[model samples]
Target: MADWASLPAELVRRIAHCLLYSNDLDCYMDFRAVCPNWRSATDDPNNSTKLRFRPFRWIVVDEVSETHSRLLINTFSGRVIRKDLPLLSKYFVVAATLGGFFVLANKEPPHPAVVLTPFTGHMIRYKAAVPSYVDISGAALSGPFTGNCYEQYKAVPDSDSFALDFDDEEWGRTFVSMRLAVASGMCAFDNWQTTVAVPPLPLSLVPKISYLMRLYAIDPDKMFSDKPVTAFADLPGTGDANHLFLVASDDGEVFAIIKLQQHLKVFWLDNDNRSEEVEPVKSIGDRAIFIGYRRCISVSANKFLSIVANSAYYVKSTDSSLAIYKYDLEEEKEERVSEAIDSLNQGRLSFAKPPFTIVQLLSSYTVNVRESQLLEMEKLKRQQLPSVPVVRGH
Candidate 1:
């Protein structure tokens, strides 16, 4: 009965959070545009405790053939958007989140650096180092002109050691020559200023982890000058690494799926010490397959939460072969299992095929692996399987 504008700021902000965390994704975006007060309440950090409640839409990308490709972005409820990134030349997706912004790159050569953010519908082109190959993966940025990378494939993007100045609104290209430090897998903190860059160096130099994954936690600030430190965690070698997603809790702990051999390993890492505590999330991975393509989409209902991922399924017999899966941790246990784990394992399983996936390490330049293979063979002895187990059931 009273005017909404006359209400206390705290009350209005609380209401905004409720709206943002609601199941309706459309209204969240709409409310952000309703008035400056609403937008401020939703985006402001003081009111951001509600940000972790939103759902995430995974964007799945897969190659249909040598030339033709399919790009899909959607939520788990069948809401989808698709595009084709033809292999005629080169195509790459740079930085993305569960939110609507997707920074995509094109590999046309001679003029190779282009970034596209789907939400603002803004596309910007940068001067990529010429005579240099296009390693689009190095092109991770929080916003326009505020990220770093090594000259394509020559190095890995490190959050703990790279330079970033997000508020300057000017692009710096000096990292085109920096050496590699972090691993191939990096994490983008909930706050853009604190993106995590992984090490590209070998695993032997670090602790003994069977599989590799990178996690970056950026301190919330406009100037991207802080260097995120490095940390390591163990994962299952036979599980799908790509299925691993990163999410940070408001309490300063980071969590993700370890995807172990027999169960899903859920780990909580201390943001300060990088010390880890592991717990079994479920026995879900044993039943699921990580085939098809995966992508991350950002949508808001209350506060901005990065929890959605979109996946496209490849089924030969159905017209509805293409599907989307959305996940939110705040949902009921039954829903998380049904949407996140169960759906991924739906197709037929074959042992001859890869139980897990191996994404070809992408680099800006072409490196001959023949020499690396020769070195590997010289360094390690070959081991063969002891025997094959007979299947008792089909």
Candidate 2:
């Protein structure tokens, strides 16, 4: 038999790539543990650009007051990694997670929000808007704020526009309606400061359309533009604004999910200039979606067998608990996934701080390694260690 242990490193690397693509972290880790040569052949999960799999774990706030430290729990292995974030604990409230970064708002005065990469310890802060009550929607780095009250003050800061005026009941209703829409997932961010508003609702006078879905391409360079490239599509059925959610898949496919009480209707956006349509989808292929107040994420279901495919895992705004319901594409029926919550956590679940966003654990940007004495020791060891001879594989 050929010597499997001494297999060509390039061949081993190709195998590692295949394993990672399958979202088999456990198998990939086991493969690395076989030998040093195997380990060196495989790319580190932390640094690999091609490895876009959702984290097996997340950093969540410990609900128990006794333990103020944050708990990093692996949903797959049930392993908890505890750490202290003094800055986060003292001055900030976590609002959301985007691209492996936490969005934090200053709890005290001024109330400036920041995008923080916990692992890398990189932070980008944004100045607080003039209005104190503006509802921020989307990711910290790229999202929009909604509160028309500030619009008047923008043109004339010193004018009477700043004065509190809520006498008009119609105006109050419109303000409340806009605020509610922002609270829902109706907003998208072009960048850190600008928000792209959803297209206005069609008037009742217009012909009734079974499905009405619109897509807008935002320009980040322009703060606010009067015209944006827009596309419209008809869905299978009319969906209410309150029960609709727009989500982007890992591969950048946009999907619209409509929740009618217990049932769900999923439509995939087919963006063709000649014919824009929302195609009914029976399955999201290998993906599962998580929807909550903070943000919605689409992850590979193959990696997490506990989370079923073609399902929506959601947390109600009023309720703190998380729930999962699978939608059968064939039967067009929605049913609760068996023990989904239990599979996620065994004991009392620790939720993240206010805003309750889920963040992926990143090893590349850990603060512990930067501050540790082991870093110096490793440097010294590297200097003294002799280089190993490179052996060419036959």
Candidate 3:
């Protein structure tokens, strides 16, 4: 046991990689807990060559009655770390996700953005407000930028999408807002430092209102540059014309599934562009792809996206459950015949599967709701009558 403890931290991490490559998450997490060196190895990017772990840390924001921002951390041991969540307010904590390394805001009323990493329970605080250009209904960190989904109104519909660069130190309200609508069906991923927004339909192919459907190709850095931006393009008509398709790719690619008339069709972005109409890459079965809950969605570079769907097909709304699907990508064959043959021998097929094998029984966590409605209620009362509108005389 002393010999095991004496091994260099790097070598232990190598051992962890060997274990992880063999699909040994249990052993890997165990190795991370073996000592301080083992745990530190988990954050080293160089070790990521063999295996990549999600960069962000997730924490459950308990809806306690605390006035200040705080974080509840689990050490993968039973130990928990609690600290202030920067400018976290009681109301905001209820609607946050634990996907990324840090959480920032895109709402009004400027405050210092909150940044935390659960491992150390240490934080970096910035005094800035959420940019006005982008609205964050829900956001997850894809690389250094925050990929967000936002609604235009109070009604149940798709929200406009955009990404904000959280790494910027200036916090000058600079952000890139992509006008992609994933009000209902959309998938997203942060890979290769780019945010890929795929429409539910093969948007690039539709000719009329193609601009509306074409995949939105945006780089938040570029969008935030000092340049006037204007462009328009139409989507090509797919196998059908009425269905919308939205998709997310783990490796910076976008896939779209659209319903034309009543037939469901699938398409992919041949090249990254929101204005070009590409052809169909595949056709899904007659069954439509299932999109999850209003706010319960996440995309990971590991080639899977999670959605909150109903447990039983015919179950009532109250019986719905969350499901996680690992949507795999189609590997490309090399030009070399030997490479092609090697690829064929590997038998790597593109498909989707569930990663959360145990919790096929899990459901959406209840979103704690608080009311700022009292202010509105009072305003409504003041507006009523006011002496019967002065009898149309004032």
Candidate with top lDDT is 2
Residue 380 in candidate 1, Cα distance off native in Å: 37
Instruction: Quantify all predictions' global Cα lDDT against the true fold.
Output: 0.28, 0.40, 0.31
lDDT, candidate 2, 187-304, per-residue tens: 2222212212122221210111123322322111221111110000112332222244455554445566664455567776553322434577878887766543223445556655
Cα lDDT tens digits for candidate 1, 1-394: 6565455667767766665443234445554554446644455465553334333333333321233233333322333444344322343444333233344444443423344444333555545421222222333332111223322321122222223234222112222111111111222322222321111222122211212233322111211111110011123341222233232222223334432222234443333432233333422211121221121112222221222222111111112221112222223121211111112122533211222211110000011011111223323433343557988986
- Winning candidate number (TM-score): 2
The regions of model 2 sitting more than 4 angstroms off are 1-83, 105-113, 125-132, 139-242, 292-294, 315-324, 337-394
Q: TM-score of predicted model 2? A: 0.46
What lDDT score goes with residue 11 in model 1?
Answer: 73
Listed in order, each prediction's TM-score against the native is: 0.36, 0.46, 0.41
Question: If both were scored by TM-score, which would come out higher, candidate 2 or candidate 3?
Answer: 2
Give the least accurate 10-residue stretch of model 2, judged by summed lDDT.
363-372
Model 3 Cα shift for residue 314 (angstroms): 13
Candidate 3 lDDT tens digits, 254-361: 444432221334466564454556666543222212222221222221221222111110001111221222222122111110100001111332111322121121
